[model samples]
Target: MAGLLQRVKSKMAIFAHRKARGMLDGEYGSVFKGRSLDFDDLRGYVPGDEVRDIDWKATARHGSPLIRRYAAVRRQTVLLVTDTGRNMAAEARSGEAKKDIAVLALGVLGYLAHRHGDLVGLVCGDSTATRSLPAKGGEAHLERLLGHVDSHTSLDAAASRIQEQLEYTARTIKGRHLLFVVADEIAADDAMAQLLRRLRAQHEILWLTVRDADLAPYPLTGQVPSAEVDYCSVADSALLPWQPAASAAVKAAYTRATAERDAARRAMLRAAGITEGEVAGSGDVITGLFALLERHRRAG
Candidate 1:
């Protein structure tokens, strides 16, 4: 775990020192454009004005529609919510552990927050237990928060009740905040969707899903000798031999199913007004995060 922290810190150091005119810097400006509670002024309502932002009282008095504008707050609150369940412990195709990828992802965001002098906090747990750290500033506090996450995360933990974590966050956190949720490739169910809707109403949300190795595309080879593979879950564990060959049709079907699932997940997140990024456990987490942030920057 110490080595993992050191590696993450090293990577983040590079990111932190990058030139202000770099792609990441530009994107960060556009993506996080002026999110603040400080009111700037009132203006004539535009066609795309958010209904919630409209000053109805002012409009009635002036007999004209008006909208309130706010300057982006310099110091923002950043919260990292992670699911440390058994599924997150699985190995990726690159042979790197999913938990490690998750930690790297968290580190990237936490370091960014620290650099900006923003308050950083965390909400992480599995089905067995959940933990939270209140938002605080300073590099030392951020290090302690990351260390706690590293110590508590376990692959042998029970299935994650992600909804419970969300509930806890919604209940405890007040005011507007930037929320980053890191978890496995689990689709949003109805209950989860409802919870996300509520949270999105109050906070800016970014979802990062760690891709599962089993879902990666593989070339089909002719039938070969069977090999033993270990399969374990919260309920049981076993090592069983299985055929290596998969027919082209089976491969195509699997690919289609994976695509459809991904599409559905994307749609669900969009509906909740949340941007999402998928990071393969075996891939460079920093690169993936940069891509995600770039996409959001472009969209914004």
Candidate 2:
């Protein structure tokens, strides 16, 4: 079988050709707060090189503007945090497996960190148990991390409780890290909000929510296109598309409830100083991640 990171790189390469090359890398690099001043080498300055980084002596000696490159004092550690449970195996809003979307999000961010010369780690689990992989560098380590998430999540796994993973991270991980979290539409409660605030104080946090499938029928259109399909929830509940809950009145209620829920989640994360992004399927992973990283950079 082909490697997952190759798939991620292919998507990035395609996006680069479509848009501007290295645009995603530039965005990812801008979010980190510090850079080392220990000089590594000097190179000819580019058009967008920082004016303050120009070395006059080097420029005069080389007969052109030169920029000093620094050896990174320390490699930043990015902790890929996610839930590997039945909920993650459920259908996403785009009718794709939610776990696949989670894999793409994690792989893209891990690859970005790898490209930035940082170590990447993984912390993922369901309600029953949590697992952590030590921070390590190299594409092999990243592939293992992605594989862990991909292989462990399934409909037969334990119920989703992302909070357990977060709590484990807070308890065991002593060092500060950039936490990239991907999960389903988890409700925001006081305890979860408090946990996020605590984590935010200790580390940089970015969230990507994999939207759950919309169970109700299309609103006010009398459309039952999927009425014949049998839908089953991760919790073993059968969801008939033609159920009473699919009525127009019920759809309206669901819409309002969903809006309120989404608003509450955004408010909670904003209060905790975390930037949140949404991806509906594999297709939206790259664009959603770009927006997420850009928002985090702007927030900083």
Candidate 3:
């Protein structure tokens, strides 16, 4: 089988081709703050490049925009935080497994960290337990990290409880690091919100929410077709297709509840001072991450 890290690189390559060359790399690099003033080199400017980084004299001479690259004062650690449990094995909005989307997102960030000469670590677990891997460099180490996430998550695994991993990091991990989290739709809770706020105080954080599959078919005008609701819930045996008599009123309630949940989740993250981006599937990972990184840079 093709390696997971290889697949991530392939996706990044495609994104680079679709966008400007080195655009994603530039976006990833700029997300961090407080770099050394020591000049390293200059590269052609992309659309997302910071305006302040442009050297006007060099740009005028070269007849194109150029961005100054600085030697970073210190290497940063990017902690890939995620949930590895039955919840992740459930279907995502795009009908792909949520675990697959999580893995893809994690791999992309880890690859960007590796490219930037930053160490990458992982903190993931289900409700039963949490696991941590020390930050390290090199493609081999990244592969091992990705493989661990892939191998552990399954439909039979323990229920997902991202709070466990978050709490583990808070209690054990030391020093400042960039915490990149990817998880599915999570219900709002006061304790989780408070925990997130505390973590934000200690580290730079970015969150990516993998959209969950819809509970019911949209525009339910009654007499919904079986094909419309073919999927079954992973956490339960509830099957929408079996309930052909479900009225439009049912759909309305689901919509309202979903909207309220989303709003609350957003409010919680915003209150914690974290930047969030969402993806529905593997296809959206790169674009979502680009937006996430850009938002983090702007917020910082």
Q: Which candidate number has the best TM-score?
A: 2
lDDT of 2 by residue, 1-300 (tens): 889888878877888876733777788887663554245799999999767678889999989899987676668889999999999998898889999889888999999889888899999999999999999999999989999999999988999999999999999988678899999988889999999999988888999999988864444346765645676668766665556666768777887998889999989999999999998888898888989989987765
For candidate 2, the lDDT comes to 0.86
In candidate 2, how many Å is residue 115 off? 0.6
Clash count, predicted structure 2: 0
Q: Candidate 3, 173: how far from true, in Å?
A: 0.3
Off by over 4 Å in 3: 33-72, 217-230, 237-246
- Using all chains and alpha carbons, the TM-scores for the candidates as numbered come to 0.80, 0.84, 0.83
lDDT of 3 by residue, 1-300 (tens): 989999998888887777732776788886664564346899999999778788889999999999998776778888999999889998888879999999999999999889888899999999999999999999999999999999999988888899999999999989778899988899889999999999998888999999987664445334455564365656664564645325556667877998999999999999999999999999998888888888887775
Alpha-carbon local distance difference test for all models: 0.73, 0.86, 0.86
Mark the regions of model 1 whose C-alpha exceeds 4 Å error after superposition. Answer: 1-5, 13-22, 37-41, 45-67, 71-74, 215-235, 238-241, 244-250, 298-300
Record all residue pairs in model 2 with backbone atoms less than 3 Å apart, i.e. clashing: none
Which ten-residue region of model 3 has the weakest summed lDDT?
Answer: 216-225
List runs of model 2 lying over 4 Å from the truth: 36-72, 217-228
Q: Estimate, for each residue in 113-210, the C-alpha lDDT of model 1 and write its tens digit.
A: 77666788999888777899898987777777777766666666777666768888989888888899988766758877888999998888888888
Please give the distance, in angstroms, between residue 294's alpha carbon in candidate 1 and its true position after superposition: 3.2
